[model samples]
Target: MSSTIAPRVRTLLLLFLAVTGALLAGAAPVSAHAALTASDPRQGAVVDEAPAQVSLTFSEGVAVSDGAVRVLDPKGKRVDTGAPADQGANTYAVKLHAGLPDGTFTVTYQVVSADSHPVSGAFTFSIGAPSTTSVALSDQTAGGGVVGGLYGFARYVSYGGFILLVGGATFVLACWPRGAGARSVQRLVVSGWLALTGATLAMLLLRGSYTGSGRVGDIFDLALLSQVLQTKTGAALVSRLLLLAAAALFVAVLFGAYDRRVRADGTGEQNATGTGDTSAPGAGSTDGGTGTAAGTDSTAGTDSTNSTDSTESQEKSDLAFGLAIGGFVVAAGLAATWAMAEHASTGLQAGIAMPVDVLHLLAVAVWLGGLSTLLVALFRAPSLDAPVVRRFSRLAFGSVAVLVATGIYQSWRQLGSWSAFTETTYGQLLLVKIGLVVVLVGIAWMSRRWTARLVQAPERRAAEAVRTPVGAASARTRKGAKPKAGSGGGDGKRAAQLARQRAAVASAAEKRLRDADPLRTGLRRSVLAEAGVAVVLLAVTTALTSTEPGRTEQEARAATAAAVTPQTGALSLDIPFDTGGRDGKGVARVELDPARVGGNEMHVYVDRPNGKAFDVPEIKVAFTLEAKDIGPLPVVPDHIATGHWTADGVQIPMAGSWTIAVTVRTSDIDQVTVDKNAQIG
Candidate 1:
């Protein structure tokens, strides 16, 4: 591999990554259940009749599998209701076993939103007389729109950048093998380091977003940061991962420097124990040495004691090279894991408590990191010498062992029941990944067999060379070199045979050491290719870990839609929530029934003499969104949607408080209508 990679090959690697980025990048939000329109018995309105059952209705259908509604009396006594089920696609109902006992009742329920988030909200409605005591869900806008958007965008970019960096570098190292202008393979290592850094920053940003931290400006503001940090669900998971990453980085820096020193020594062996003397008996230490006996087995064996010292020096300079690769894989997996988790569950605990996920991550890192290290060695090894082969084989074996162990543990953890193997997505994908790993192991085994075979060949040849030629030539030459005086046949033939054997052994030894032989090069490339496949498999594993292990259930309940909006006396309020028609779109339409619920008297006010548009200079109107910081838009029209916003469409853009200021200030009375700003799709 070359130090400077070719532009085209680099471009292709980058292009592939860019595409993967697009796949994982944030798509538009999907529309989920809209905000609660109106709860029957209207908050606090006491009714004389005892209802048979309690029901809650929404703007859209509630997912029955993950949705539930509960009715509680003021004393916190639960009312008996047949399993709370979705009455209509949009209405959730639970038949109460007992009725009467008015005071105040609270309907608390949670729904598994289409976006995969478990969202819960409660509303209080009185059974008999309305209660004065009431409660509202507390909400705070964590940050400004610009800050939040940048935060999410930065996270995505970091993830893309990390995957691009590692996957790209590894691809170059394995597939392109010194493509075009790259004079050496070191460039891949450099690229890997840069990418790992990008991933670290990304993970950090991800933590910030999920935890709802606004900015560094809020770090010292413990009240704010703590709010984000103390959140049991996301906070623990994000914090632990951040700490782990920081620890990993610190280790990487230290080990990277150490790894360089090892490479710089020019020994060609990572753990070589040197004897120091050039003419020592240790020359064939591995018995057919590469690094152990510096010049014993490589093509450059006779160059000088530990001759490629400079080449080793270069390896030492490449710090964090392998770790960079590991970091990339780890980061990509974590991001995908968290993103999907956010989609599927509400609290972070559900996602974090999945021990299988943690094991899956560890397994991926070991496999990917080990494969990268092996690949670098594959290119650097000058020959298929036993010592070099053994070293790599040992390292490869360790990685394979860890991968197998972690994989098995993960499988057991995720698929607890035997039937789960074929029943769940987690099971099926795990099987596929496991099958691929088996194949990879088979290939590695074959390589190991070849290396071991090569190790025994030299001694076999040395013995044959000494004995076979002598017997053959003597059989032929005995007749030709026969002397009348019987010229010392035995001694002379023996001497000649010995000389030939010496020459044969020397030739075999010479062949063993050729630094640039085609056969050696081919073997090196082959091993490299094997390692490359190993790395790719690792990336795939990472992807798998990030995916959800199940398909959403299709069964839906009976649904009913109730259109409700705020009422300011009478007039009419109509809203067409436009979720830009595109991927990740989230559109909301709030239509107030009659555009008002009450407050309209039989008489007329100054806002409008008749039930017509009141001609006023400006119709000052203000309304509050149920939740602050609406968060990311869901796959469906959902309240916790990201990039949430609200705006005035018509005359309501101006800010102020006004009451029935009906005046013909505007030239046209029809132009006095107003619209509010809603969250962007």
Candidate 2:
């Protein structure tokens, strides 16, 4: 009835968790997914000259994928000299050719995040001034939507199957009731192994396509597969495949030992049953005609055979026990592979995080996988033993405790702040996962309650055993009936009636215990419900694993702050204009320092429609505040450089959307105008 976990069990669980965590840390990647934090030649900046190199800094370490970074000129021509090289833990740099002229050049990048997810974005910067002809980012390098979805699905399958195979086998060997669920348990374990194998193979192919061109044909491309194998992700997957192969061998040994033990026990049971019949008190007397000497010799032979059978059964059981232990050791090492390759290994305080993550994964496998196996047992079992239910209750309690503790730490590490939990997509998804976990825990609680009831039901039946002494009394009455019948007819008739009644009562009780136990039925229902909820929990967990954590998003926003910070600058643009249907062209340049709600100077340069500098008869500029609906302030400019004009002491009130229009007249019959919009801050 005690709800508290025992100190000894708690201590042992903690030790196990700690040791597993350490082992997992050694193989973990020790990083989180990367997000771009800062970039050199900041986006939308008006630089005086092109820099020799462009650099990008991320929230975590990253690997450049194919076509990872490309710098394009205004005309959309590539200008980057080579691949971007990692300058530091989180910085990547790309060199640019000398004397590069740029007008709104775009830098598009695609990199594999530390956690192996693909991330991409584009930004623009200009030399001298911004340009209307900005370069566009290409979609050729982007993964196709359907292929990406398939890859994610494969990842989910791999995780689920891996947990089930490891956890189910471990639970069966270490915790399942003797001689129960032999075939079903083996099938569960084998199915898990097969599922994991299929998922891993599918993932390898899907990953190749996902990281490459995302074409369906790429899934079978040997060239792409060879290239993918060279990367860290591919290596981790390959390692998993090898580990799974070893696990298959271990599983076979374990199962073979189990089969030997079962067969030995079965033979022993048959021998014991045969011996019992021969040694029955009434049977030996009937066989006296065969001769007393012969009977004694037969008994001796049977005794010797029973002794040898007992010894063989013991040996088989011992062998099975040893094989189970070895299997568990191999599974632990295999689980460590996942911890090493996942986000847990790459995040903050990786040494500590990796171990905690491993423990977390271990807890998940134990709870979810065990529940799945238990559910199967419930459905297939005629009558689940109370002892088995009680044992599982304890195991589940310990596993959930570990899960809760590790989950809190991971949430803090990934979210950084409470506000992020509400503000970011990753945080929102995490909340969903947490909510699902809570539901699963509730279902688990119900299962535990049901188990407690089941254990109590047997105790209740023991009390009922005292109330149902008819069977025992009937045996005594039958033994005394012959003597009593000799003494009196009435006594013999009464004994007969009592014997019949006792037989009826005993038969009813046996039927209830063997075929209609209500507690077993209820326990089955509860376990089935818990298993169903666990499936949903796994789905949510998969989503959480795929999501980008809020911490990365926060870092990205901080890194890009400079790009949006307001600064005083002039708006300069070159507009090509033609008037009077002539091939003549003109350029307009506007200069406004402290381009805000204050006094400023405005300048413009113009040429006749022909590519010649010709003084215009008249030139005028107009300003409008579109958002405020209050502008059209016209200003006449005095000629400065023949075709060039200048205006000073121009006033701009209020900071908002503003438009500037320039009108020019080459002669009485030739005139043209152009307009441009700018944000005044």
Candidate 3:
């Protein structure tokens, strides 16, 4: 135990360190987001006259779906600015009706970033009075951080750690009871748990780019939380993952107890010695290990041996191991279930990633976990005997086989073609991993065959076995006295039992004679080999996941979408020529029109085809301009009710373009936008 246990522990630690370092180093960058660029009616400015509108600009494209701005009076009463609309992808604006009654106004804005994250801020300024400049706007944003740094650590370790502890550990259980090239259920369970926990940490930190706020609580905000809950795909996924985790723990408790209790069945019994008993089942029951006599000391025997707590504790570990395994497999299964859902991609290449990823994760568990077991066997086993070596060989073989098979399948699906294996970052990393696995497997196979042959040649080959579990017959003879007097039957029964016991004894000795020793020396070689190989694979897998798949393919998809998108100049428009009452201010319409935007011409029609026949003959036009920032702005004049002629707000300053879109809607034609570019000189 001393010789084998210590080395294996060392191997595990080293391997773990290697994998950790590799993954961290290989992580990629898909992070960038909307930044506040500028605002109209700049913060903390005083003016003699009232401006008609307020607007905000961002560094990148932004959507106003979750965006709003409040202008409050010094008394904190909200002054209504017209509804904000998406003038362009990154711009939002609202108009104020008449002149503002001169006082301070505070403008506060909360906008949703493109990735759906939120940003909020506020500022105050005056219009004609000092009171207007003193208005305080609410600055609290929607998102919440998980609190202090210590709290964040606790949150991640306690919350995120528990997920991996349960998931990875349970997954290991499902992959356990190892065989050659096969991982025990436990290996996968543990890996899944750890990976998930790690991923959660990464998501929290990385989510800022996607969400626009570097806050944990913000990810769970009203808007963000709603998206998760309301989306059919999102809610179902999260709920199922949680349920699977819970159910695994539930089942693990029971399985763990059962496995632990039943585990000693083959080795815990003893036969009465000196009678030369050789029965395979043995004569005395393993219950004797409790040191309480089964027949003679039965009355209070159960109470004295061990306290209830110790027994319960052992049973609980078994339960935990069991549940972790359950959860792990279920996670893998649930991941696959997503592929068949309606929301999943359904094309030939559709739904492949979801299922393939689950399988790939399962393989990672088996390969990595199996490597741990190998290291244990080589460096930690108490005996280097033949049977133990053989047992390990079988387990190792099964693990490797499964690893290779699953890996190939995953590559086929994920890579799309053999060329992708070299072309894409993800595919190339996978190839490297496969290469490492081959090396590890080769080393193990060589050692396995070498030990098996030595067992046959060296009589009394205990060393060949390499940490074999104690045999049943040996355990029984260690029990001195026979538990029974008559023992169920007469002399005939006794003789027959004695005869069987003798045979069992003889067989155990013969087998032991053929087993080899110091199997650790050979196993150590394999364990080190596996450890090294496992390191490389870990890095490869991490790098693979960090990169985007097929950039060219994504581009092709975009190109196709563009082909179907609406093109300009396909539509024409027209509107009525009259200047309605209120002193010649009304709707004026025009046929085919192209509104220039920043020198780029925008095709506009009266909501009709560019070449189509239109209604009303002539169109009257009026224009009004509103200048923002850069001055005590005055409203420009306009004539007649005219929707036909474009209004240029070129009077606005602050290094940006202003847009006035011509909306032409007659009793007949559809509404269209003829957006004219306005540059303030």
Compared with the true structure, all predictions reach lDDT values of 0.43, 0.68, 0.45
lDDT of 3 by residue, 1-681 (tens): 444457556555444644454453423231112344445565567788877777665544444533367677777766755668666525677666465677778777666443333456676778876673455544333332332222223222222223333333432343332221122333333443554445434433333323334354554455655554444334444554575566455435434553454343212222222222332233244544653344334333333333443465466466556555665666455444333332122223444545655554555544455555545434433323456456545655665666567666556544556676677556666677777776767777777766676456454344223223234433453465354555665755765686577666555544444332344455566567666666666655544533434332232233223222312331133332222322222332322222221112222222123333333223222222222112223222233222223233322222223434443334343343244444311
Error of 3 at 399 (Å): 5.0
Of candidate 2, the 10-residue stretch with the lowest lDDT total is 23-32
Instruction: Please report how far candidate 2 places residue 175 from its true position, in Å.
Output: 2.6
Q: What is the lDDT of residue 270 in candidate 2?
A: 73
lDDT of 2 by residue, 2-120 (tens): 12223332342233323323322221121225555567786777899888988886656777854688888888888888788877536788888888875788888877776676667
Which ten contiguous residues of candidate 1 have the minimum total lDDT? Answer: 553-562
Each candidate's root-mean-square deviation in Å?
22.9, 20.1, 15.1
Model 2, runs deviating above 4 Å: 1-32, 132-144, 177-181, 281-283, 289-306, 458-515, 566-681
Worst 10 residues of 3 by lDDT: 592-601
Better of 2 and 3 by TM-score: 2
Error (Å) of candidate 1 at residue 245 is: 8.0
Give the residue spans of candidate 1 off by over 4 A: 1-197, 203-227, 232-360, 380-389, 418-423, 453-536, 550-681
User: How many clashing pairs per prediction, in order?
Assistant: 49, 12, 87
**Best-first order by TM-score:** 2, 3, 1
Q: Which one wins on TM-score?
A: 2
